[model samples]
Target: MPNRWLCLLLLPACISAVTLDCKHIRIDKKDFDLSALGGPKTIHQQRWLPPSISNTTFTIDLCNPLKKLKGIDSKEQCPSGTRVCGIEERYNPIDGVKEVTEVRPIAGEFSTSHGRAMDPEVTRLKESSNADQEGLRIELRGGKFPETRQGDLQKAIIELHCDAELTGNEGFEDDEAAVDVAGYGSMSKRAKDDKDDEDEDEPELPDLDKGKSLQFVSYKNEKDDVGVLRLTWKTKYACENAEKAPAKEPGNKSSGWGFFTWFFVVSFLLIAAYIIFGSWLNYTRYGARGMDLIPHSDMIRDLPYIAKEWVGGVADRMKSGGSRGGYSAV
Candidate 1:
């Protein structure tokens, strides 16, 4: 009985652990759809340190786990459910070789939060003087660095900028262009073939050019902190007015008559009905004929004379100019 109660209590938390829907992100009563930017993006940075050159590659996917690309090794990448991963390699000039130094899971979890501090935090970026800078910021902080003694948590901060011209896939010539997966070339032929087979099962990435793709701005690692990585991305989906209710089709007419139109229509119908009934009643009862059969005949006939006299009165008033006949007091 106690186990049953515990299961019931845990059901709500499990149900709420589903992945976030990037298509409809509601912020400040406005919705921004980023589904167009859904796919893994890889970035590389190289720095010279003493005799060896250090190269770092970072991969992230907002909508799902990173796919198995051609050059990236499964072992060097993040764990199965990671959303962001970073790997660093050092090249020695003397040995003419490169060595994989670190594989860091920057953000993701094996399962639900379960009271752990593993949930991703998303918030709106503060607006600046430049309109293009408006966007969202996401902070992911559950991954751990494998080299840290204290099991230090890894953090990744992603800033999305609003760029209508970008689709987020710009500058990447091919899927494997930017990826330098460590140890991939050293694998045996059989292992390489197996990896290739796995990659073939995955869906092909879209062929996108710089004209309509997401633009990668920059990546910065805080010098004071080794566990933090900040990256900036520009896409049209980050704009405030990215998605709105689709406009009505041009060929479709309005659903119904407007207020004034209905009012005038109803009014004309009522007046016509009244006149027809009055004329019919007069002809039946008194055998009326011609103009006499019309309702309010006298008033209708006098309308033209009444209008003429009103116009003459206005003309006389204008000519008199409200002047006194006698001389004005001096």
Candidate 2:
């Protein structure tokens, strides 16, 4: 009897365990910014721009179209099981199609509007920044309203924040480092095998895997009564600096030494060879010894003496022509 009663009590829990169909909700990478000081950080269908502890506003844009709102076309409704959370439409005023800022939920079903309604989730949940606390702590809280009408849907968005601490490595890469939020699991997709372009001169980045994983944090369907989803991530600026390549030490010699050393050495050898060859030639011609062979042997040992005697004779014979600058050619 006790076992049967236990099974009967557990029947409702088993039946209500259907996973919330949140495959449609997607995070917009562009709307998310870690640099804001104290503004609406998360982006949702409804606009909420003020009254936050920090000026930073991380936005999550529901790229998925809405389904069941009061004034919207039925063709625009979200999937059947999902209820209406927020309506994002442009008001066609006389000026033109201006963006509607007012938060609109399913009419006559829920009174709450805007994103601040998520404060309760933040209050209920507690999260710490990374161990280093490298940046501002952005908290997230979310849940769903009871299904007053059939197919009532709950809308949720994720927020990422970096604290006042700024790591200079920010903006180094297009993709931000994956964040590991406590109790929230990892905020990045699992890695897959894809070729990386090593030719690009990109700086070292965190070893986060990039894959086509669904960008959701968590979701819970409350016994077909309400559905809740929550997601949080740290700002890219909060990531730790990647290890930089070590500085190269200067070489012992200058860059040109290899060519210059070989050139000088070869030049010296050639010059020594030329002198030795000339000396040998002079020795073979005149049979002179020692330094006499350095200059042409004929010029040093024979020509100077012969020229002196010849010049003395010529001077005596051609004094008159010499004085007139017309010496005889003989």
Top-TM-score candidate index:
1
Candidate lDDT scores, in order, read 0.65, 0.35
- lDDT by residue for model 2 over 1-330, one digit each (tens)? 999999989966653332221221112221222222121122222221211001111123222222334665554333232222332333221222233232323211121332222221121112343443432222222323333345444544343344234322232233321122221122112111111433423222223223211123544454454444444443343332322211221222334558778999999999889889988888999897887778664566777789999999998877665465656567
Candidate 2 ranges beyond 4 A from true positions: 1-59, 62-214, 222-226, 232-234, 237-330
* lDDT, candidate 2, at 150: 53
Candidate 1 achieves a global lDDT of 0.65
TM-score of 2: 0.22
Per-residue lDDT for 1-330 in model 1, tens only?
999999999976863554555766777787877765666777765654534456676777886766655676777666776788877777554345677787878776555532223466667775443445688887776677663456656777778887777655666545442434343233333333444353433222222223424333444445544467777787777778775422332333567889999999999999999999999999999899999999999999999999999999999888888688747978
TM-score of candidate 1 versus the correct structure, residues matched by position: 0.54
Candidate 1: minimum summed lDDT over ten consecutive residues — where?
Answer: 200-209
Query: How high is each candidate's TM-score?
Result: 0.54, 0.22
